[model samples]
Target: AASLLGAPIGHDLCIISLSDLMTPWERIEKRIRAAAIGDFVTAVYNPKSEGRYWQLYRLKELFLEERSPGTPVGYVRQAGREEQVVNLTTLAEFDPEQVDMFTVILIGNSQSYEAGGKFITPRGYYGEIKMKTDVGIGQDIMIRSFRTIEKELKDKEMPLDKKWALLHAIHTTADFDMENILRIDDHAVASLYEKFNRGEVRTIITDVTMAASGIRKGALQRMGIEVKCYLQDERTIQLATEKGITRTQAGIRLAVQEHPGALYAFGNAPTALIELCDLIRKGKATPAGIIAAPVGFVHVQESKHMVKPFVSIPKLIIEGRKGGSNLAATLVNAILCYNDAEQLKPGRDV
Candidate 1:
């Protein structure tokens, strides 16, 4: 059966006969229940015959209790013989009349599927190679850059999401040192992806106009997310002068007040990052995430360290004072790239 079906029975499986000739009906029922509960792919032999008709119906009913209606079920009659016949169907659509003593019924696990006239039960390595091949042909440079980064960081212990984000950063900056210096909270970037995909994030607040300008406008427009920088606003100037604070800091305060829960990306001013952390700590603002990468020596490290304790919010921080507007924009674009890749349909141009 395995040879005929291209190794569908390679995983956990059991074989049960429903004839009840040598085995009692109660024992066969118990075995079927055990297979179903154990999540084992089952093969039924001698399912039905002229004298044994009701047992196959009972077996299907019991399996349906534990399996999904759409679970793939394949039956092969007279396997490896001249009169061999094979048919693929789901558990809900299986006809007991088509199965007889010479038929072998193979029931798949929950992860199985029927495609291209074949039934397949994936064993965890299903689409790994296909995805790589697709990405290789679709985006050659991106795939090559990712592979190079993966090779370089082979020994580094980091989460997969962080590795992907850092790969884009290194690809943009061409600086390998950024890999070690970047600090990402666990699942931080993934949280951003979730918010972005769900359309929950509607606005992006940037400290500088340059950072805002760097974000992909078309992508943001398609996603219905607005990029805003209040540095040029008249209100920001008045507030900064009155409070004796930097214009970027005042802009952040005002932006947070106006666009609560918006993502904040700061690339030029350490004061802006510091102000955002202070505002969040004071309960004056609640942002979706923070991408703080202020480049300089003065208070840069301090400002980044201030945001480190914000464990609840997703953050992508360049640990030292080694970031600039370009890196910040690159990080934002990296997120957009991920979103675009997710939206890419098979056989469609990326």
Candidate 2:
């Protein structure tokens, strides 16, 4: 493989038969001197045998004297056999006597290690290992959207045409202030920006009040990603524009895209709820078809006229359902996992 790689143009290559068979020592010395001066990543095969041994040292010395001490040298014994041993070390640390007729040695150039790890050398370029965060979202509603994405990544079974399509699909998250409305303060925005830059997140699900507007929008655009804002207030919309956030109004806003999908969840403030209904009425968004908490504290009640049109409305208790959060989470899990629309029932929708 080395000789085949080097056989181009006017560069002369010399191969010495280190085995005690055909080539003479005087001729080998001449070739070695020429090779030492030329500076190449030489491959040595059949450097040792049970009968003859000293030639390996001579070859090593010839290369070592000319090349830098820290140059990478690889030794492979028994090539593809079961007992194969491949060791990579510097020229200064190589032990030539260990080689035999079945062994191969590769002497690399100085910049070899700096270029990348050896494993990636099989490819055309260097490799990189940037610090990354593995998203650990559970198999909840927020995670179902990502489930398809994760499968596509793990399969790597797609054809070349479909590969990039899967990669470009949105892997997102939606957050509703269930307990306390999580605000997007500057600190939170900064943290989110870092995560977005690292490809740890794509779609951000947050309400308008959690943050100032212009920074998140501008920063996300600068990072070359899409940021969809769910359940935004009028003030948050202004702030989102100023923050340069990639604003997609409410979950249904994403339906305007070329590929329309259901919102990850169905519960938010009444204003957001009505916006979702409007989208559904317009045929722009489908009911996620899952009720989040059916018998819980609903802030909004369907009007008498709308109640005839909607099946989701009911009387609200003074306090929210016990473990409303857990029930919502469980329902989302069921919907996402079983692909059962029935999961939306037994509880409240939005």
Candidate 3:
């Protein structure tokens, strides 16, 4: 049975027959108490019958004293037979009436979880691929979307990082033509992941409040980072008014001054992108990376084109003036997701 179940039963466990006809009830109780106190995953055979019913309830009571109510419980009746019934439940929901002489009950320790309709006791490989295969709805959607994007780009020849960026651009815009307009340096995508993982990029400066708000705050908090948008700052407003420049441009200049080597994400104002490009050209600011996706008819294309000359730093640009805060935020999140070192293994599907 252990071999058939793929070694789930190989862990420290004790099996006891609940038939009290030959074994005295006192001795059975002692064995149950020992199993419960020792924290052993237990299997009970012949759990109940017509006359022997209260023993299963007694076993539950004894186990409850030591185990949590959420401990997993699995039941199998008529194993290997035609009329077999297998169930996965919890200790709090265990029904003694469901068991009989033909049933085998396997109760789990503190580490088990219900996954894909089965009880899984994690055997210390929580970060392995086997444990990650079953994900929740949000992750499942992202994986499926990536798969679809991969299938659509099967004929294209590009590196995995670039492909990942392109796929995310397409995913954000729902436009297959985005692959043509997306601009990413050869090593920029990889450098972005490295900077993010190494904590080199600690602050994310955005042009607009929408872009700043769209970034996942929880994800940034987990990485010990902060997002900033200085467009509404009083100093920025005063500086912009005094210099006769847009508030976003002044904010970008101020942000670069305050947080050097910060990630710059521009989604709204082309002036902000233009200011960032000017800062880079003048050596006044050294940004970790730039996400330039300003949506406008005026100078959006021109501003993005301006940033093209500076090739020393990482940049993710959505060309042709077809971008907004949502697209910019999506691109940032895509980079964040890719920064997960464990998920970016050599042969990983995503």
Which model scores highest in lDDT? 1
So what's the TM-score on candidate 1? 0.58
User: Which 10 consecutive residues of model 3 have the lowest summed lDDT?
Assistant: 341-350
**Consecutive 10-residue window with the lowest summed lDDT within model 1:** 341-350
Q: What is the lDDT of residue 90 in candidate 2?
A: 63
What TM-score would candidate 3 get against the native?
0.59
In order, how many clashes per candidate?
0, 19, 0
Candidate 2 per-residue lDDT over residues 1-350, each given as its tens digit:
33222211222334455775676788877777676666554666677777668887887787766664545667778766788876666666789867778887776532222112231011121224321212222323322343234232433222322222122112212222222211111222233323444655444322232221311343345445443444354654564477564343433354333223322222333334344455556767443232222222443344112212434322111113322322323322222222112111111121
Candidate 3 clash figure, as a count: 0
TM per candidate comes to: 0.58, 0.31, 0.59
Over 4 Å off in model 2, which ranges? Answer: 1-16, 114-350
Ranking by TM-score: 3, 1, 2
| Candidate with more favorable, higher lDDT: 1 or 2 | 1
Candidate 3: misplaced stretches above 4 Å? Answer: 1-133, 339-350
Please tell me which model should have the higher lDDT, number 1 or number 3. Answer: 1
Candidate 1 residues lying further than 4 Å off, grouped into runs, are: 1-139, 154-157, 339-350
Write one digit per residue (lDDT tens) for candidate 1, span 1-350: 65466435556778888886887889989999999877778988988867889998888888777775556788999998999998888787899988778999998765455556767654443335333233445454455455445445533445556766787678768888887788888887777877887998888888999988888776686677889999999999999999999999999989988997999998899999999998998998899999989999999999999988888988999988799887787777666556443221111222
lDDT, candidate 3, residue 86?
Answer: 84
lDDT value for model 3 = 0.77
The local lDDT score (0 to 100) that residue 46 gets in candidate 3 is: 88
